[model samples]
Target chain A: MKQDGLTIPGLLVASLVGLILVAALLDGRGAHATPGEERLFLPDAKYLKPMLIGFHGVAADLLWIRTVQYVGTHVETDRKFPQLAKALNLATSLDPHFLEPYRFGGLYLLYLARQPQAAVSLLEKGAAANPGRWELPHDLGRYYYLEAHDYARSREWWERAATLPGRPDYLPRFVARLYAETDHRETALELWSEIYRTAQNDSVRSLALQEIERLKAGSSEGPLGL
Target chain B: MTVAAIALNTFREAVRDRILYAILIFALVMLAGSTILVTISVGGEVKIIKDLGLACISIFGTLIAIFLGIGLVSKEIERRTLYTIITKPIHRYQFILGKYLGLVLTLLVNVAVMALGLLGLAYLWEGVSSVRLFLAVLFIFLELMLVTALALLFSAFSSPTLSAIFTLSLFVAGHLSGDLRLFAARFGGAVTKLSAETLYFLLPNLSRLNFKDQAVHGFGVDGGSMGLSFLYAIFHIAALVLAAMAIFERRDFK
Candidate 1:
């Protein structure tokens, strides 16, 4: 039998089915309750702490997103940092090995949230679990130097970061400058330049390079010129 | 016995198709490429890998299910091989079931290889094997099985082009049935609600089979939930196959 041409009714039926399917898939709301919010507790709360610690990585991811979302735009204030710190503490405590909440939670708590103390605490947890990783300690040093402005603490953390395997070559110089003091600004600019040049990821390199340029433009006649 | 032979032959034929290999290779490359992409991600690198891996598995696996499954019976008919097979003592349902099973075997092998690759890559990154990942992959296989049934059902009564379109549409609807019910109840009028309900029942509800998000995050498997999902897939496949058998049994090929 010869195949019949495309019939109008057949086309309409197909169109209706297509429309129905599209309408179905376009609805993307998740389940009503957030996964791990109910289980949050402090380490001092021993009975509740045990339950909180057992929550899984997916719950940790959700809590991390929710915690950041909850912290909102007032992120730079000390008030916002504590709330975020509390949530991240809960999240990472639940799933200690989850890499994202550690990196992102620490960045938000330290840099954006302006709680360098809390950031240090969180990154310390990450470092303890993920021993030998250079990034976590490097972040710890960044928080101390840039946010806390404690040169001594910054030098200590940077020294630790430098000793870690897989650390960049210029980290040792940065750690040395923290103690030498004489050429610290010039060394920071140089270190940032190396960060830009040798960074593995483009975005990270871009951010580092931008910061170096900003520093240079600010202190044109300063150590940046040398 | 003849039906088993035909099914085995078709399975071998599908395995050898260059299109199948092309899709398989592409999916593997993307799954592995996710590792390199993870390094660039500022944070949530592991989540990114799992997200991309799971999405690739579903999309590529669905393509394999629909393309091969839609053509299984129609290709036989088109090539006039169905006439020879139909003239034998074998029943039409056996032929249909055998063809469906053959495609399913192909999908199982493809899904297993992809799942193992995803699991291995994830373990390499995390340094721990996730039992949840394997369970999530099993759910993906069940999802594909529902789609294979849909394709076979459509092919029983329609042209290959129509069969492919209908089956793909069914796959999409099944993925979103829960959301569709919500939309209908909340905003749609009476007619829309009824139509949505009808579709909800007629199409396989594949969203029920998705434990990927939960599993990917290393949340332990909910055994009861997985059992329910398996039952749902099996029931859907049974209904579709029965419908196809009924249609094929009545059709006059003379």
Candidate 2:
């Protein structure tokens, strides 16, 4: 009887330790994996809205964070952001007043994803949804000026951005310069250089470098390049 | 005096429930996990933490309210404890009110603990305490009280299983009532519009009681609206509790 009691206790302890080790190994495997590889499929915002049960803002916040992770993971390997725009779209749709996803998502779509048209559409939606905010219109203007090379649209957006409250001081100056149409190549070079200097990732830096090089070669080719 | 005694006893009973502690522990764990969640967000880390933390408290707190509230009367009846209580020198309405108060009190304690954990986490993140976050939590507590009243109303008339289902349906419907109103205005034709409008007015407008968006964004919530929401919650809760009392008074004990 004494030996049997000791045997039971020993078996219980061994099983407990064995279970903990297995759990730790599983946890370590999950922790070591890249966050991007674990993509979450979110349902449509219309269907999701009612199910959120008044936690829509919290859901939006989580989706926005997931979009950031998607960008961080894909920006390195595939240089493809298939889900980034969709995630941002869903997040903003759930909470239309959320401003960050529109601004930053627009930048990522434009520069890294090379979806300039989609970027413009997203920024336009953001501008309409958030009329009082200056950042959306300001970003729209920047995309037009730098990427699309559509000076007329850029000037129009910049003028609108300038009229809004909290716009940076440089916006009005850019609007004026765009209207004057003076030193276009120099301005493009300066914008690309700034983006290159402030870029947080290798993809953005390389894109900026390519733009700078293109601008430099064009400038060397004189007014015909402009 | 009798009602107070029953209320206190019910509160003690609720405190000892293992499910309450289980939900409370899960809520606290999720609130603590907000710290890890914030590290992944590029900007608005503080907002993410506060938003998720408040959501965890509200969601888990509602589950506790519904689960416990539904069992308040039925569990007593099932254990033959209701006979002893009804045979006492107490009215059935008093018993119902006592049960409701006890659950509300229990919810108050749990929500306060969760709120403090969230606020402590928020302070650690941004180094400042937010009055708006607290106000949001207060409204969430009121919402939970309303849900508890709902559970009690169903419990007085039905089985605990059915009561849980009814309370949860109402919770979903209450939150969606605003959208229902909008749908009526936009798409419904004559009879459907009238029916939708009538249901909208009859149902609880939970969206009015939700201050999470205003709290997270630091937007100024108008004082008049806040007062109106508080009054709405009070009137709705009172109506539900009175209805429960009326049903309990007519319920067959034999």
Candidate 3:
């Protein structure tokens, strides 16, 4: 009746119950994951945007990291990301000027996830917000060329990028190829030839040569497989 | 001369606070922890590091200012030294000003330490330490000065707990004033809109002092904006400090 501590038996029982509860929670979480649970139920950026007291850049960076992890998680298990666009949208809305999410995240949607329209929209959003920067525009041009195969739109984006400061020197060549009304096969060959010319490593140079030789042989396929 | 003496003494006392060291250690750890977080990110490693680092400095520096600043007056009163000090040759306004200055000095040293840590991390990650980051820190310092003044104003007449609540609330409100104005203008009714607009203009508008985005991206911050932020902070701090002095002037210390 006095102030004696809990006996070893009591602690052991408590620990057993605690471990079982944790296991139950884990099991429930895994079993009950619907589309709603895919993104961990984080609210839209509009609701959470004002609460941070103007730490939008930091918020955007953290959200972008989460987006990458979300993509990675889907890549491993089901390869079905129902909330990929939502995740990307949340990060971009928090910081419209953040280009990495727009750039690499767009590539993920296009090449990896095969969601072409989402990729184009995201890249266009980035380009619209950051017209002064060429990365988004350049990536847009590449996406249109590789996946969409819309030469006119691709050339327009490439020209915009080429005019912007800090664009890669090869961007003008891409624009030129588009302007000459060359077909996708010839343009693809020229692109690889340029890569072969400027290859810094033996492996990259070899890859470029293979791509170029494949194109030159008039294979019906395109470069940079989707 | 007397204010300077009080300010130096206050600075010495504030430096010994254990809470300051705790906050400083947490900030340094976060700055270093960002490196670990960057390993998984596919791009913007340098930008992520810089953004997190600057956010750490701003958030922690404001905590330091508010936490230390709130106690500047109450601690002396609690220690029963206020009576002894006020009876001396210094006026109450000078006392308030000196206390504010001392905390500002403390924030300067703390912010500079955190700034150097952030710049060092950014350099290690990116191979180039941008001097423009300091421009962000400069604006953060101005924000801290305004927060300190708010804390001092509340501490002049209220308990430390209430003072912290008031100061922190105003700090958040100041940052959100712009958004509040937008929401009010777009959605609110006639009277509600008018009141929100008035409060928005009357508040400190701390978001104006935010330059972290400019630092992370580029030097989009021009000279005109910096000058405007500085002038805004000066006016707000002056008004808050004067209010604190008036409250202290009429404070009836039993």
Candidate No. with top TM-score? 3
As for TM-score, the candidate ahead, 1 or 2, is 2
lDDT of each candidate versus the true structure: 0.74, 0.87, 0.85
User: What is the C-alpha lDDT profile of model 2 across B91-137, one tens digit per residue?
Assistant: 99999999999899899999999999998988897798888999999
Q: For each candidate, give its TM-score against the true structure.
A: 0.58, 0.84, 0.88
Report per-candidate DockQ: 0.08, 0.51, 0.46
In candidate 1, what are the lDDT values of residues B97-134, reduced to their tens digit? 88888888899999989988988888888899887877
Query: For every candidate structure, what is the RMSD over all alpha carbons to the true structure, in angstroms?
Result: 14.4, 4.5, 4.3
lDDT winner, 1 or 3 = 3
Tell me how far the alpha carbon of residue B227 in candidate 1 is from the true structure, in angstroms, after superposition: 0.6
Tens digit per residue, CA lDDT, model 3, B1-254:
88898899989999999999999999999999999998877778888999999999989998999899999999999999999998898899899989999999999999999999998888887788786788889989999999999999999988999999999999999988999899998999999999998998788999899888888987566889889888998999999999999999999997
TM-score of chain B of 2: 0.98
* Most accurate candidate by lDDT: 2
The digit string of per-residue lDDT tens for model 3 on A5-43 reads 557668889999999999999998888775325654457
Worst 10 residues of 3 chain A by lDDT: A198-207
Q: Can you tell me which runs of candidate 2 are displaced by over 4 Å?
A: A1-42, A179-226, B182-195
Ranking by TM-score: 3, 2, 1
lDDT by residue for model 2 over A128-163, one digit each (tens)?
998888888888877777767788998898899899
- Model 3 ranges with Cα > 4 A deviation: A1-37, A186-219, A222-226, B187-194
Candidate that scores best on DockQ: 2
